[model samples]
Target: MTEPRASAFITRNVLFALVGGGLGGILFMFFLIEFDHFTSTNQFCTTCHSMTFAETSYQQSVHYNSPSGVRASCGDCHVSEGIIMATYDHAVGIKDLFKQLFGADYNDPVINLLHLPDAAFASRDWFRRRDSATCRRCHLQEAIQGTRVHTAAIHQEETDGKSCVDCHFNLVHRPVPERSTFKREAWNAMVEQEFGLEPGSAEQLLAAGRRPAGERPPAAAAPAHGVGNGQQQAGLEP
Candidate 1:
């Protein structure tokens, strides 16, 4: 009788354990599904504190509203497709959240890139390095048959390792004028530096230090040539 009672008690405990474990697992799965759904939405992304400028630009972009009535949201372009990529993105998002919470001047770089002169090349570089996988997912090459020469040329040029953002950097957003002037100033600085003239005094220095065409300066005179040229092309101040 005692043996039977012990067996009954063990069975009861096992049943309770199974029920509790099953419920916990179900709750966890439900939470994950809800979290994923929430994060996938454009509203969640645009509402984040760091997204003010980006949100404004997105609203003004053709992607927001076009003749075809199609719209692409922030997640459509910024988030990688697939569960693994999404999980990795979320992990990065957590890190960014922590930075926003604790780091001083967390949004300084974003502000500088949007408004300051000679400080936005890093942002441009970031755009340049992105893979066109997401863009291609929506704008498939096979579906892009058109008679427009420029459009066709741009599509064909993708074969040369150029991403869609290369030519269409400002497609969804108007670039800051200061950023454009920064590029020109940076170029002039490179020319000045190559001729051993003062930086930022490009026009005056280049004029006074002008060397004849095909007349290469002494190699020692331009020790920083490579560095200057890289800064010029990248629109970065040296």
Candidate 2:
């Protein structure tokens, strides 16, 4: 009788353990799915106390409001495609999170503007590292059969070694120079032009040497003798 009772007790405990584990796993998955969905939203991204600058400028960008009525939200560009990669991106973004919470007072337009290039360059580099995977999500290079005379050839040429942001940056933010030509004065000039800043205020900031690398210096340019010249001849870019 005692042996039989012990066996039944052990079996009951095992069943309860299995049920509890199953429920816990389901709840975890549900939380993960909901959290990933919510965090991918533009509203959630811009909810930070310091994201007003990004929110406003993004609203002004073509991705936000386009002629085709196909608007790309913040997540469409910023978030990776798969759940795993997207979570990795969010995890990496903790640096930005800490900055917003404890670093510079980005609420100030001037401060935010000062740091804008840093954010922009980081984003561009992310695209490069991912081989412009996010851009390719919407724009298939082979499918870009367009009216521009040089578009097809340029696309083919760029495919040899270039990523999309290598030549196609500055479309969505205050303009930064092409990576090949990015220098301090040039970046300052563009900032002034787009932001309607005082004619030389940015230059003055440059002169004062505040944040020497507002935009990271371009990589040493590749040889301009072949591919570079071809793009130039076609009136396109590298």
Candidate whose TM-score is highest: 2
Candidate 1 global TM-score: 0.54
Q: Which segments of model 1 are wrong by more than 4 Å?
A: 1-30, 104-130, 174-238
* RMSD of each candidate relative to the true structure: 13.3, 9.5
Q: Per-residue lDDT tens digits of candidate 1, residues 98-211?
A: 744664332332221213222234445544566656686678865676677676655765557766666555456434333444555555554555454556655543334333
Off by over 4 Å in 2: 1-11, 185-238
> lDDT winner among the candidates?
2
Q: How many steric clashes does model 2 contain?
A: 0
- Global lDDT scores for all candidate models: 0.55, 0.66
| Candidate 1 whole-model C-alpha lDDT, 0 to 1 | 0.55
Per-candidate TM-scores read 0.54, 0.70
Quick one: RMSD of model 1?
A: 13.3
User: Candidate 2, residues 18-107: lDDT per residue as tens digits?
Assistant: 899999999987877777788989889878845655666567778878889888877788889987788888888889888777776565
